[model samples]
Every structure is written in structure tokens, then in C-alpha cells.
Target: MKKLAVIAATGLSAGPAFAATGPFFSLRNTDFIVLVSFLAFVGVLLYFKVPSRIGALLDSRAAGIRRDLDEAKRLREEAQEIYASYERRQREVAGQADQIVANAKREAEAQAAKAKADLKSSIERRLKAAEDQIASAEADAVRAVRDRAVQAAIAAASSLLAQQVGAGQRSAGIDEAIDDVARRLN
Candidate 1:
């Protein structure tokens, strides 16, 4: 590479000198030699099939690029499909969650209603029991009062009869009661 640069520099520096002294169509010119050298270089490259090799290299590179582009496009489509599937799944999950919430709410409402009914029934049963107890207590009190009154009336009648009867009448009454009892036993 250094040698090529040195040669190119020498040629460029000598170019003006050659142009000033040379006929326009001279075969002994430095430009002619440079032209011949360039032609010879091209001829050597062709003889070695370098042009065809370069063309093949470029074609392979293009094929690789095209394959990469196709792979990228396919990957992009797959990613989009996966994203769409995830979105669909999310929506389904959201809908199921809504349904679950609705079901939970309905169950809560039913439970609340059942609790209210149970509480009401319990209260009603307690109230009825209390009323029955009150009524029974009232009947017992009335019976006790009637029993006490009957006992008092019987005592009063016995005391008045005892006071009104004389000793002789009381003895005759006892004799009569004894006769009546003897007759019943026989």
C-alpha cells in the first residue's frame, strides 16, 4: 500500500512536466504508460475471474439481507399475533371478573335478606313466648284470688253458724249427724 501511494504521488508530480514537453499524440508519454498499466491491471483481474467473484459476493450479501428482512417480518407478525391473543385473554378475564363480582353481590344480597328474615322470625317467636307467659301468670293470679275468696266465705259462714247455734242445739245437731252417718254405713 505504501508503494502504491508513492507511485501515485510520483505520477501526479511528473504529470505537468510531461504535458509541457510532449506532443498531444505521442506513444512515449507517461499518460500512455499509466493508461496501459490500468488496462493491464483490468486484464489481470478478468483473467483470474475476479469480476465474477465480486459479483457472486455481492449477490450472496443481498440474499443474506433479504433472508434477514423476511425473518424480521415473520417475527413481527408473530409478535402481533401474540399481543392480540393476550389482549383477548385479558378481555375474557375482565368479563369473568365482572361476572364474579356480580355473583358475589347477588349472594351478599341474598344473605342479607335471609339474615333479616331470621332476625324477624326470632324476635316474633320471643314476643309470642313472652305474651304466653304473661297470660299464664294472669290466669294463675286470678285462680289464687278466687281460691282465697272461697276460703274466706266458707270460714265466715262456719263462724256465723257456730255463733248462732246454742249449746243444746249444737249437741242435738251432733246427735242427728251421728245417726245419719250410722244409717249410711249400714
Candidate 2:
């Protein structure tokens, strides 16, 4: 590597000297002056270590970019976790609402069954009362018919006794008939 560098330097110096129109080392030679100025500028850059400083700056910038990317990834994962928690809560609430609706329906069905039973009982009681009233009315009608038959029999007996018996015997016969009728009625 040292040999190659030396060869390259010799070539650079010789090539400018050959190309110059006058003495290569003299101030009148523009090529020599240009070569000196370029060498000085290169020497100043090397003395300050500008290339190493630029490399360090670029490496620090790359590290900062990597940290930002890591932070963004962590924040995205946290947001996803929060979204999942909300979804779970929403599902739980929906399940609770469904349960409430089912319970309400059961309650309403129970109420309807109770109402039907009550109505049936009420109708049965009314039917029993109507039957009792009809039985009472039938008993009253039978009693009235018996009373009318007894009265008509008494009137027929009185008319037959008057036609067949004389006055004194008729009174005695009527008294006997009344006593018999009272006994039979009792």
C-alpha cells in the first residue's frame, strides 16, 4: 500500500510539470501554483479531522431515528390493547341487556297466566250463582202450584157436600171435612 501511494504521488507531480509551459517550480508557472493551493486545502481539512466528525454526526442521527421508530411501535400496541378492552366491555353490556329482556318477557307471561286463571274463577262463581237462583225460582213455582190445587179441592168438596146433605148434617159434615183436610195437609 505504501509503494502504491508513493507511485501515485510521483505521477501527480510529474504529470503537471510536464504539462507546464515554463519552469515547473517557479512562481510564473500557474500549474505549480494550483497544485500548491490544492495541497494546502487538503492539509487543512486533514488537520481538523472533518471526515471523522461528519461520520459521527451521521451515526447519531441514525440512532435517534431508530428510537423514534421504537416509540411509535409501543404507542400503536397500547392503542390496540385499549380498543380490545372496549370491545370486550361492549359485548358484556349487550349480554346483560339480553338477559334483562328475557327476564321481562318471563314476567309478562306469568302475569298473563295469572289473569287467565282469575277470569276463569270469576266466570265459574257467576255460573254457580245463576244456577242457585234458578233452583230457588223453581221451588217457589212448585209451592204456588200446590197451594192452588189445595184451594180448588176444598171448593169442590164444599159444593158436593151442599148438594148431597140436608142443612144440620151438612154443617156437621163440613166441620168433619175441614178437620180431615187440616190433618192431611199437616
Candidate 3:
């Protein structure tokens, strides 16, 4: 192994021995052709493959942009739908509130009407009671007046009859008449 390593090292130390057999001018002339060939090879590669690679990259970017635009449009439509649904709900709630207010107003009006009717009925009952009291008082006054008038007439007749009859007989008749009235009252 050491001998092989020494032999390899000796071979590598020897100067570069490979050289072209042609004259230097011929080789210098070939450099121009080689440079042109390399440039043509690069140009052909650009013409044939670079545009396709670039087109693929551009298409990928365009597809991504299109997808983003479509997503944005879809999201906008969804937002608009949600807003419209919310507005519809608001309208329904407002309508229900209006209906509730109307019902409350109707209920209040009905209650007011009932209260007014009750008040009227109570007033009528009070008025009837007052009228009855007045009528009873008037009847009692009429009876008292009639009884007083009858007593006055009886006294006047008794006085007149007393003047016509003898004193002793008139006194006995007056006493008997008073006794008869008392017995009838019992």
C-alpha cells in the first residue's frame, strides 16, 4: 500500500503532459467556434425551454390570482346575503312590535270602555237610591200633612158641634169618640 501511494504521488508530481497535436493558431481558431457553439447552445435552450418554464410559472400565479378573486366574490355575496337576511329579520321584528303596540292600544281602549261603563252603572245605581229616598221622604211628608189636616178638621167640627149641643152632652160624646178612635188604632 505504501509503495502504491509513493508511485501515485510521483506520477501526480510530474507536470501536466497532455497537449493537443495541432498548431497553436489552429487551436486559437477553434476557440472562436467553441465560444460560438456554447452561445448557440445557451440561446437554443432559452428559446426552446425557458419560455415554457416561465409560462408555467406565470400560469400558476394567474390561477392563484383567479382563485383569490373568485373567493373574494363568493365571500362578498355571502356577506350581502347575510345582511339582507338580517334586514328582513329586523323588518319582521319591527312589524311584530307594531302589532304588539296596536294590541296594547286596543286592550287599553277596551279597558277604558269597561271602566266607563262601570262608572255609568254605579252612577245610575246611586241616582236610583237617591230617588227612592226622596220619594219615601215625599210620601211620608204627604201622609204627615194629611194626618195633621184631618186632626184640624175633626177639631173644627167638634168645636162647631159643641156650640150647637149642650155642654154636658158634647163632653160625653167627645170622650166616647176619642175612646172609639183609640180602640180602632190598637
Q: How many residue pairs clash (N, CA or C atoms closer than 3 angstroms) in each of the candidate models, in the order given? A: 0, 0, 0
* Candidate 3 per-residue C-alpha lDDT over 1-186 given as tens digits, one digit per residue, 9 for 90 to 100: 999999998887662332434453453556556767898998997978987888999999999999999999999999999999999999999999999999999999999999999999999999999999999999999999978876786687688768877978998878776676556544
Better of 1 and 3 by TM-score: 1
Evaluated with TM-score, which candidate comes out highest?
Answer: 1
In order of appearance, the predictions have TM-scores of 0.57, 0.51, 0.49
Residue 159, model 3: Cα distance from true site in angstroms: 2.0
Least well predicted 10-residue stretch by lDDT in candidate 3:
15-24
| Per-residue lDDT of candidate 2, residues 1-186 (tens digit) | 999999998898788567778788888898778889999998888899877788889889889899989999999999999999999999999999999999999999999999999999999999999999999999999889988888888888999998999898999999998789878987
Query: What lDDT is reached at residue 63 by model 3?
Result: 99
Query: Which predicted model would earn the best lDDT?
Result: 2
Candidate 2 at residue 163, lDDT? 93
What is the lDDT, from 0 to 100, of the residue 104 in candidate 3?
100
Candidate 1 residue lDDT tens string, 1-54: 999999999998787646556663567776666777899999999999999999
Q: Give candidate 3 misplaced runs (Cα > 4 Å).
A: 1-82, 179-186
- For residue 122, model 2's alpha carbon misses the true position, in angstroms, by 1.6
Question: Candidate 2: where is the Cα deviation over 4 Å?
Answer: 1-86
Assess candidate 3 and give its TM-score to the true structure. Answer: 0.49
**TM-score for model 1?**
0.57
Per-candidate RMSD, Å: 10.0, 8.2, 14.3
Tell me the lDDT of model 3 at 137: 100
